[model samples]
Target: MNGGTSTTTATPNPSTTAPSAPKTSKPGRTSPPNSNSPPATATAPSSASTPTPPTASARSGGRTEHAVSPRLPHGASYTLLALGAALAAAALSFTALAAQFDNNVYDWLFRVHPAGHRPHEAVLLAFDDRTLMDHGGVRGLRRTLASTLEILAAAPPRVTAVDLTLADPGDPAEDARLAAAMLRLPGLALAAEMLPDSSGWQDPRPEFLAAAEAIGHVHALPGPLDEINRMIALERAAGRDRRFALALEAHRLALGGGAIVSTPSDLESGGVRIPSRQDAGRPLRVHYRPSSTVETLPIGALLADPARARALRGRVVFIGVTALSAIPDRLFTPLSPLDGNRPMAGVEIHAQSFETITNRSFIVDAPPIIPVALAFALAAALAAAFTFTSAPVAYSLGLVLLVAAHTLPWLAFLGRLVLPPFAPVAASWSALAACAAFRFFYVRRQLASSEQTTARYQQAFHFVAHEMRTPLTAIQGSSEIISRYNLPEDKRKQMGQMINAESKRLAQMITTFLDVERLSAGQMDLRSSSFPVSGLLDACLRRAQPLADRKHISLEATAADDLAATADRELLEYALYNLLTNAIKYSPEHTTVRVSATRDAHHHLLAVTDQGMGMTPEEVKNLGRKFYRTERAERAGIQGTGIGLSIVRQIVDLHGGRLSVESAPDQGSTFTIALPA
Candidate 1:
């Protein structure tokens, strides 16, 4: 109704998808036959042009000629339309930009991020050469104790979260300096060291806990199975109390909570129940910044460096050390550079988690039902539109549909559209494209069939014409020789024999040609009647006797006494005759050519095996093509029309049988016809 996107709603028939009404068109359509006078119909095929269409009907219902099993009921169009609309709607809804994005499947969408954009307030604690040279090396804090409290007071930030651990409680002044910093910053939180409670002892640092406004157990986020970080959990226990996770707490602190958050009964349903979180979540989707190489900044640079430090004022600063000390617990984020090294501390990861929660952006997957409906609708629409058009246009439309399906995922990349990339769109487009290709090629084949029929007729005509010339010329020459000159009795008899031989060759050639023509036209109607199987071999053996005698080749028949099959008599006879003739023709002089028919409990087989100058597989392959002779045979000067076995195959097929040949150069071929007994 609205530019091909309908808005009508109907209750889905839960029982079935097949719609009901008067038939309109089939699932896939084909055109009616061609337009020629006399009009081709299944009945009276020969007299009524075989390749032509019937006169158009007066129904005047805008019908197109198509070859399909059956038509879809006209009433079902609304159902098809409804399904299509639903698909389009679902794609738009879950795919939109402002929708709740799932951080879980983000790396699936984006694999590599360039230099990320960091706009959040975060501080860096650089272990400078000055601090290192003051003491010794890695553990330089043992000497001169500097107060972090002074640093926190100087930089005005909403939150002061430290990443370091006071592993050694012996340095009382150093511990005191950190504690003093916690009291000065009202929103300051310390990353607490986790002690395994296996011994049932709680080692709580009262002074540090008392000074800090909030204490978060320092724990890192898990990376993807492939070491990629796409998501962070926002809801978790801070410590003993069921308090908000550090990220959640940070977000709540920034947005100013309306009510203490409570667990809903549906926390398992992947929904976060936080009060007045709209603002905090709106700005947390930060572009990432790599912490190594060019992205590295010393602690002094964050505090003393003007450009970045100016940007950090009034924003909450979460300070943490970026080190790869996995002998201890680490902040295992997805985007670390040290060969998939997990983030070492949880404090900085909490900053990332807070940033994501505040931004309120996530990825969403469209419903499964949407794409399924989409594919069916797309396939149906393409089939409908091209049902009446020429092949080229239908093919072009198919390609367009294919391209459209391929381009679908790009919407998610550029404009945040989560369309189906796997089953429905891809699968349906492929099906449509296949339909288009098959239909187009099938029509072209039918046209070619008509032309081939004409060509076959032309070739048969010339074959007959050429055969007549040989015998007619011989007869004329023989008569002239008799009339124009005196000849001895023996010489006259020889000339008569010459004329007789050519005439006989002409007859066999003509009969064979006619036999094939009838078979090709599909007019050689068979009269199915049960017959004695050995009767067939017995008949062909007698027919092949003369040809065998000419080369002194033995034509032998061996068969089990009784085998039965219900099939046409003449068709079977023709097939066996061709096999016998080839055996005699290809075998060398005096070679035995065996003709046998046997029946096992399951099936009956008719086999012809020849011994002599056997053929290569290439020769056997060309044996069925009209006018095609094997190169070796032509060189050997064997002569006959080339379509004998082609006719044989047609006859075998009519009997629901298979014909197989086995041969190699110099090894005789065994041709076997297998059929149900």
Candidate 2:
């Protein structure tokens, strides 16, 4: 009983609502309320209240008014941002390149804090040419050294390191004399050299070794890339025996020669874990004293000035060759205060290394992952910056990130940490630029689409004005005739009839305009029901008959009365009426506009064929565009806004149907609407 009531109510509702539905939908699809005018093929005016976002219609490589404009999906924007970040992250993983920039930064820092300005406790007693000349050159070096050792024993210094490879044997008597002198001083140390291939060692003579308090290797390895001596290995292998570097050994002896903790990769003195080169070898970064900080005097000068010799008491003294002509032993270093091109003597380098270890001053290099992680962080920041901000703001953020890149590393360097500065800065700016460019192009395309839409609206407005002018003039002229003259009853009645017809024509055009707008916005709800095709065709013929009679064109329908269609009857009637009217309007007198309905395999086809001035291939191709008009129609003074076919197509699409036209110049045209049965 409830279902019967619901069905009965629904049946009446559609019929009662059918006429009123066109009041809103068709008016929006055709024209507005105040517009009771004919449309020269006019289209619906866009709603002022509803804003349309700009979008691209097609990617034609060139702009065309007919192409659709649609907004870019958010997914594509996100994908571009991710792509930029991934590329940046990939580039940052090359640690070697980043490390090179770090090395350069360190060089600059060393320049700012040059060596030799600060006072150093350790002193250099170099065996220069002056000492050599006094002792008769190399031949008398052993005797001179033996004499110096005896003087050092009389007024013993805290510690004395002989930074020389005393591997070569000398006269037995001279060796014995040097050995006796060395035994007198309990704080004496001798230097040894490791073989280049780490196979063996060049130790001091057996007599000298027996006398010395400690022995350590004097070999220093330069940096792998720049070949500058910036660090020193704490331990080196000599055959099966491990040898400490000269600096480590000297520091140990200075600390009262305690039991040293040593390993292949690390060393410890006084409970201090020695900071050394990581991964490659156990090389420790040297904390250098200024070249002038360690006061140097020739051995002859120290021997000549007894008072000066007394000042060396309780000081750690390193004795090595400094004269270029004699030993010529010097190498460039990062900590070179005076000249980059000139080398600091080898002995000075060893002295600085010893100072570094004894003072526990070390530089810490961040782990390899630090740079890679920072690179990703910077990339993500740039991505977010672009995402949240406009192009100009994002660019400003990029500048800030660039500054941070260099600043952070510099601060870390000051804190005794080695952080790479190159990759993070480069990646941040690159990612920013890529995202910015994508955004710029996207905005440009959107603006172009908006402009095209505006142009379309402007054309639609003009079309409405042009279309309404004709009927408005006719209505005014006919109304004036009926009012001004006292004509015969039949003549006045005829003039009055003309006014009513013109008014109705104007009203229908407005309705058609509004219908298009509503349908396009998907606001038109179809009142679907099964109805005979003949009924729809009969209504269209009745409406188009007046226009057909004016043109003296024949209007015929060949649809079977029982051939039915399931669709919005009123909307379909409006569509068919438009086709019939257009055919009558464009065709010459005595032409026939045939309306027919036939069923095929899957669809019932509603076709309107005319033998009028047909369109060419190009005109047919562009027939469905809003506000389009053919040049042939224009020449023949035919009235149309060119949007009739556009409305027809939209109506067909709403019904899940298709509309197609076949035409050629001078051959007339056929328009078919295929609706599923």
Candidate 3:
């Protein structure tokens, strides 16, 4: 029996919910109508029987001499497999693509502008050791401010921004002087440090506040979850006003007259997204210049005491500490993780902020679609790969994909380009591993079941073949005796014919039953050899002629003598014999049964053509199914057990040959076998 569709087919139970039985007649000549015989067709293999070729529509290939079984009748396995594959594909696709996650949006507001970009544009008036030496400790602070005020008055900066907070004055005189100096400058702005808490309060020393009318609130953006600087917000909330970020504020002040760069290109990111604490975005572009380059410098120092008490003039001057652990300190920057960790002075933070805000060099974001798509695609692929691939290979491939997705986004960001980031590469990979593992185990279980069923079928075939041998032999012997002792000429001839007919029928029944069981059980063995196929065909024809002669069906061979191949000789012969016998059996009484063999450039072909009550297209479609008789064939009173062609298909497959059929209900049927030359 061809496992072709047997494993995929089920038997209709006669006792339960059976269809209406077709009418039948007693067997004297031909049955009046249909009997219990499946319509037979050309041989097809027991394996796959999908109609890749048009002929497959006519019949399935016969079962090969291998562990072949009937196709399973249930569609459950196929449905489940398809469902699993789709799900796996979806999951793998996602994991391989999507990107969306980002943490902490408040950080972008608190940009530490780099001094690189605004070097010549801003001045840093430090209350250094020299300035302090020129005066005294508390008194020196006074001299430094008095001097700064002197320089600012001479050459007023575009807009002086004093990055100083005087909540607590170590020296009141210097603080007072600074306040006095601020009042003199027409457009000087004093930075007020906002409280780090949610209250959003500022700590501008009363002295400084009383002197300077405008307060430039200074607040660093919130750090990402990982403490990295990746984004900064354009807007920030202050006491009563929704204020621009420090960088924005500085830029606004610089362009107070509204004559600086106006393009979106001027601001990094156009202040769209905020940074995540996890990491800083790509580095900003900066152009640092010495304080002397700006008008707010040492009033007049083309080349004085190179590093003097007063060098800043006509520019934004920020003052702060630079020592290690000045106060509650944190000075991390994106320049380099290891170096950025060191505590930084307040003045440098202002420098960084000023440059960054002014330069507008910032990190772009990962696109929204990139991450989402990646997640879906990777998830699906991983699921499928895990389903079929080995654990190590699946994991390894998954790892590579994950790394690729992750690295790709990061690299794009570094290049000032945006891509998606929220991809579930890691998750998808793991899921595939898990899913594939489950499938691996599942397939093993199914294989075990199939193997067990096949073994049981083999046992049944052996037992049945053994059990039927005795009765068949007895019937043949009895028929022979009755034929030999005929009383009259007509009686003798009739008896002889009956004996031959019965003996042939019995033998055929036994062969059909044995072949079906053996093929289904996968117990058949092959004796392969290269031989003249012409001789084999001749032998099969001689053996099948008696049956053909009885029916007045003419059988003839028409194969090219040159055709030959290296295949299982016995199996090939049996398969060929089966095809020829079927042609003779189903053929109309007067039709010519023609068998032919030919060789092409790449293949050797064998064909059997019969003019008989053939099959409809639909009936031809499922030709090799065990016990599946065509409606037309059954209507023709064909005496068949329905396992012959199926067994033939099995043998053909075992020899690496193909079987196909072409037939129409009214037209004669033709079966072709192709073997690679």
Candidate 4:
């Protein structure tokens, strides 16, 4: 059980695990509790729990807790990081930023698309400066209105909503003519204004109001910051009096005049159901068409040519004084002229609002969560591309993301969904910037690490090459002496032996260096075969005997003669060569180095122990780090390139084994390699 536990604990889950996606809950749109409705709050469904992967923190905690799940490839980690940043930015857009940026983007989209379709039934009759001058100023304005109404009454329009607020009494005689004309027309609905203070509503002269078929409020609320009129309130209240908007009343009367009927949430008249704005109780968003789309005629012309009024027979005629001097009667609109000075006439604004209601072309918006979710998803995609792809390809993908962000809004606009462009564009750009930053840092880190490794390897290569010269020089000198001189048999035999030993050492050094290179480059595949553990240990001892003899150290091995391992024989031999050689090189003269193999039920342990100047725990901890050598080893003039143990560890890992070190200052050291039996 203990052995099983140890094995289970030793091996870890793969390092490639990452979170599949960001775990976030979207807030559903909720309505405030109405006096007659139950109190309630709506929340989006919660996300599922994410799998935790073992990270540095997890390992240090000795458990999987606090582990960050790895859902992305190692190179694509930047993509996930960017997604997190995009979500944060999007959330901020709703709070501290207050969606100002988002609104601005929407405003831009609104202005860029000006050519729009307007309802065919709504028409504008402007009492402009030209019409006023052609008629005879304010004294004649009432006559002009009365005359136009008479002409409209002759043919009878579907509905005639005079946007004129005839609040204060007009000339009594002229008012009588207007009232008479209004009474004669059953399709006529007059406009009125309600005071913000809930004071009594204002309407045309009492006689004129009494004579009109119906009365509707003409007051509109401007947008909060810009004071732009984009939406028209469907209804307004003045104390006990509830009045519908001019557009709503006109629409109702146009469907055939009758007692206006409506429900708490909608206006219903003559079996026509017009849905009211209920989301957050916001006013209906006006889908404004160009000012030119509302067929317009000067009020004077209609009065001058009574026959021309026949063309206005089936339309809902909106009559208002748009003369610049006629009270500067204009408001800023989304489709306002590009010059920024030309505001749409109040009459035209009313026409557009009424047309919007009649045609049911009100603008809709996607849920707030949509743009946010899409932004994060795009950011993730960009991050992944930036991480795994080349610079040109990643940049191209980023461009694609940008185009996608901007284009989606236009498509949504076509569908009458007012999807703000800024959040997505801002999110995508922010994500790209974040991913770019990550790529920059990632490249920098890799370059710095690579440069450091190169420097260490270059230095180690020079040292090892220098060491090779000594053995090569010995072989060359011994061989040259044997061939060049007529020496005694004993001296010749000794020289020949020296040359042979030096040749063997040189060949082993070359082979080990080549193996290290191949392993570092990931080109070495294990060539597995079964071999006796004793044979391997004995071979390592024999290889190190000459070096151990030079230091007057005894080499010893104790292992089961029958025990064997299933791994590449040549690779194991190289690993043991490094271990045994290091044991001999680091130990003091006359010290003994012990090699032993022991097995449990699941694994075999091969330990190399040396009674030498041991290391501090810190030193032992750093033993297998490439090119890491202790200060004591440096001071003691030990000849080492510092990568031998690194190579040994790599080989053991390739053979599905683990390397462990045990050491303490002044207590010697033990290096253990554990492999499955």
Candidate 5:
């Protein structure tokens, strides 16, 4: 009867022990324990029982607690960067840098593809050097003109346009001779020039003007960038007086002499449409025929053989100086070799302009919005490329986009549409580079974060195995001894108490570890309340007094009773306790550990000072990193997992506090936690 009572009292309750029995039991076996049961079962009935599995509601709540908040997708950053790059390029397009590039490209297109298969509607009667020499060095200009007109009247050209300005009066007898020669032509047009002041036109003398049918302005403006002649202004105006270009006047006379009907965008002369916009000063892009293809007759050639006048029959004649030294009217064309090495005579350029008007071959400029639209399109393509595709494939597609930007302008030019080459190319390159750099850095950051998380998890496992081993072993051993023997009541009670104490310690460790992790991840909600700082410090000192006594160390704490802090009391208590224990554990025997709390202007400062084997400045800086310990502690054989300070730092951070340390080698360390008042 005595043995039965002892066994009943010492044995674990059947209801509590029954659940854990299956953990060691083999599957599909329901027999009671036998002599053959493994030794592990003997220690399984401990106070540290495994926790029950959570229910469905508990698991669902856990997921809800840890779910991440919505944020902007990673691709959005890349897309925004691409847009910025493209917009910068578009803004730069309106500057002179882009226009210069466009001009160069326009010239390249003309040089590569000259006009083909055009009717010769105009002729150039060049006054070469030989013509000037034969006419006595420009002094006999009136005699030369009278002789050339006599030969031209026999064949009778449709219209004769003189490019030389007769605005000033020459010798009266010579001027009258030239005026009579001009009246004998079937059709005559005299050249006028704009005065230097731009106030009025320099018209021919009254006698010369009376013999001519029309007077046109002889002005050929050069390109702003390189002084190359790519286009001509068809109309010039001074106040209310306006005059058509020399080429236009000749075309009008050749088409049987009718009034030129004008609109803002174009001109209509005798049924021919000319694309000359008024807003742009009636600009016309000339389609230059090759110099070799133009029908040119020097004045000396006509005088040497009268038969050469047949070539001028029924064709509008442009008479001007072709000798390079005779006139400064020479200008560069797109077809000029080496940019400006072979300049074309002004008379030939006018003949080409007339041919362009007659042949109806025009190169039209694209609208201003077209380049901007293309830039945006290129940016969008590059953004999508980096967003949805891998790096290698995205870069390959980017290369292709760059090539398309360069080639599109030339292709458009072939179709008779002029597109600027700068905006699309600049935008595409800038966007590609920007997107690639962003993706590169973003991927590197994500990889670094992943590596850090993996390392932290590995450290956590080490901490769990190291810190919980002693308590788990004590609980298991105590349970084994209590379960294997029949003993006195006092002895059984003692073993049971040991198991209970170690099991509670293990549970506390787990709870503290979980709290620290939750707080660091921003998943734990702090419980805020006002508590006296002195009361909190006193409680932590009491808890750490035993450890200090074991090492023969004294603890000194100072706090004002009236001082208080608004924070999570439980978490703050844990933090203060951790600091106290660390101070006591690291201090030398008979040394003192100090704990103090005080309030400043805006914060509650809690400090811990220890006289241990002190730390270097570098070690103090690294104090709060998990599993990081100083060399002094390791050499002193101190028993620690190095996770205590990390937990303390995390807890204080949750209360909107900062942790600071002041220390040096061989000097005691002071750690301070400053909480917002």
Candidate 6:
């Protein structure tokens, strides 16, 4: 019965049995029978059984086998992402939306940190509601102005600037009286207006213009976004006809009427350098004096007493309408109430402009590059913080950066610099958010990878305990029988043969496991060679035949003798053997597992078809994932660790091949490996 069984087991073909044994030693002496020795000792004599050496191309390729180069370290990648977000936000600072936001911040800084100790060089003589009503309203504006000027002449101011436009002919008698009264003042600057269409200036009447020493435009330049009067254009021109601002004209006359010197970036007049960039419309950021420090004498009150005229003696007097209902020249200011209930009058705004020039309290805007550079520096610092420090330290540093972004503007404002808060604030916030989110997700991914690795190790432990225990027990039992029992020579030789076989099996199992792990990690180099596909299939079938016979399953293979493949032959054999054994293990008794090979013009295809409990499409899709098993297989209590197919897929992929599966519920399954020709 034993001889007949041996004949049946070896009946597949002589070629299969010949390749299964080591070429260098006799079949019985291929490995040592002593299980007490290390596994390496059993494998050492079977050098001819080892896989071929790696091809020259694979050796030269080394670590470059991957199509893509390794990525930058996590710190570098995170820094770049954060910096990109910050740069995007900084670029947004120059847009109109950020400008609008900056305007509000500017106003906030102004209110929080007001100027100290103004020069008090200008006074307001207002045409208040009481004065206008007492002087017969708007129709009597010229008469009221004439009467007020006559009183001011008693103690003439150093320079008197009117914030009114007398561009058209009024009542002739009243105009004559106004001209006569204006001539009594020592120094006079008359206010002209830009036409509504912006085509030209509306100069005062010829008679009145001749009476004034200097003529200036009364155009208050408000912010285009909010219409808030934050700045005043120092110089305005229309078709070769240029006019200084009313406040500039008044200041020039007050300081002995010096000629205004101009430059692209600044204006110098009255021995004062104004930081007003001509390309930016010569904008002079007005440092408005506190309202309480401004002295105002209502025209009606001045006329009633006339003693208040002495208060205007050494100061420039800005005379204009202050009645909110009478004139529509009211506008907002940085110092205006937040609710917008109080808007400064245009005349008062001009007076404040004059005070700004006199006090040399100009708020200069920071250069365009300042904010951009700050954004970059802040982003870099944040990147470094996260990279080198712990979480609490990094987050605390991030909070400090945020505070710096807001506080820097205030400090600069105190130094008379108008630093827009938008850019730095936006950069800090965007970089913080981006880095924080990246770190959050990166940590999550790392944690998930760690958990997966732990689970995989646990599964590997199960595989070792389940698959290797049988061979180990057989080897240990046979070794003990040889060491302790006094048996006949033939019986001892049989036990020794069994121990040797199980040792070789255990060694091969360990080698295959290690090879799969190394290959999956991209650390193994493949030994490429060309071989006949039929011979490879025969070898794999011979190895899996014993397992198939135990379950009463049949192994069937079909391939042409001329069929060939170029790949790692040992790995391919191992993959095919795994597939065949899995098929036998999962299939019902009396079923057949088919192994076939074919070739097309560009590729060789190897397929294994099994008559077993089939898988659903979802199960098929997830088949080769490590530790993944179908519900049916688990329910049937199949003895598997679910890692065999994963190892097979890894081996095929390393050789530039693809493994594909096709199946449906309650039907047989087909696994195909397509290798490059």
Q: State TM-scores per candidate.
A: 0.47, 0.70, 0.45, 0.63, 0.78, 0.81
Q: Which scores higher on lDDT, 1 or 3? A: 1
lDDT by residue (1-677, candidate 2, tens digit) is: 13211110001121121111111111223332232442212122212111121112211233222323336544356346745664665575465665566677787877775543444667888888778888878888888888887888877888899987789988889989999999988778899887778799888989899988888887777766777777777777779987888778778888888878756555678677785643557777786655756678789987787567677788888988887787755777775645545677888888888777766677777776776677667767767777777778878987787688668777877777767666666666666666677777878987997898789878877877777776676556555544544556875665566556556666666665665665566655555789988778776776566556545667777775468899977668767777777776778876788888888989999888899889888888887788888998999977666776777778789799998998877778889999998
Q: In model 5, which runs have C-alpha deviations exceeding 4 angstroms?
A: 1-84, 171-174, 271-273, 338-340, 367-369, 441-562, 568-571, 587-594, 609-614, 650-656, 663-669
Per-residue lDDT value at 356 in model 2: 72
Over 272-356, each residue of candidate 3 has an lDDT whose tens digit, in order, gives 2323222332223222222223222322231234344334444555554332422343434343223434433345455555665
Better of 5 and 6 by TM-score: 6
Using lDDT, rank the candidates from best to worst: 6, 5, 4, 2, 1, 3
Candidate 3 or 5, higher lDDT? 5
Q: Which stretches of candidate 6 lie above 4 Å from their native place?
A: 1-80, 338-340, 387-390, 466-510, 525-535, 538-566, 580-594, 609-622, 627-641, 661-670
Candidate 5 residue lDDT tens string, 1-677: 13211110111222332222222222223334345653222122332222211122333323333534437675787789888988999999998999999989998898888788777888889898999988876777767887898889899899999988788878888888888888889779888888898999999999988889988887888888888898888899976799998889998999999999999999988799987789888888888867888888889989999998987789899998888888888889888874346788887888888888888887878887998899989999999988898889999999999899998999999887789988898999999999988888988998998899899888888788876776676566556645665556875776566667667767656765665566567665565889888788777766666556556667777777677899877668877777777876777777888887877999999998988777887898899997788988888877666767887787777788999988876678788999999
lDDT of candidate 1 vs native?
A: 0.54
Per-residue lDDT, model 2, residue 191, is 90
What is the descending TM-score order?
6, 5, 2, 4, 1, 3
Better of 2 and 6 by TM-score: 6
Q: List candidate 2 stretches off by more than 4 Å.
A: 1-97, 115-119, 129-140, 262-267, 277-280, 325-329, 335-340, 464-612, 616-626, 643-663, 668-677
Worst 10 residues of 6 by lDDT: 38-47
Clashes of each: 24, 30, 120, 6, 0, 0
Off by over 4 Å in 3: 1-160, 167-172, 183-187, 195-200, 203-214, 221-234, 257-317, 333-336, 344-347, 366-370, 381-403, 415-423, 453-677
lDDT score of model 3?
0.52
Rate residue 412 of model 4 by lDDT: 90
RMSD of each: 20.9, 10.5, 19.1, 21.9, 9.3, 7.5
Give the per-residue lDDT of model 1 (tens digit) for 1-677. Answer: 33322221212223423212112222123224334421111110011010111111321334333323225542244235433443444454345331223332343344343224545444544434443443443454422223334554665567665545544464676667656656666666655544564222222367767866655544443543443343443333324543335555555555443333443321211134432222222112222334442222445454344355444456666665444431244543434543355453455556655554554433334445655566666666565545655657766876776676556554553443345554345444555655555565766887899798788778767767865665565556565654555566875775666656556666556666765765665645556778877677777766666556556666666665546678766667767777887887888875788877777776678899998677776777766667666877878976655677788787788788888888888878899988777
Worst 10 residues of 3 by lDDT: 44-53
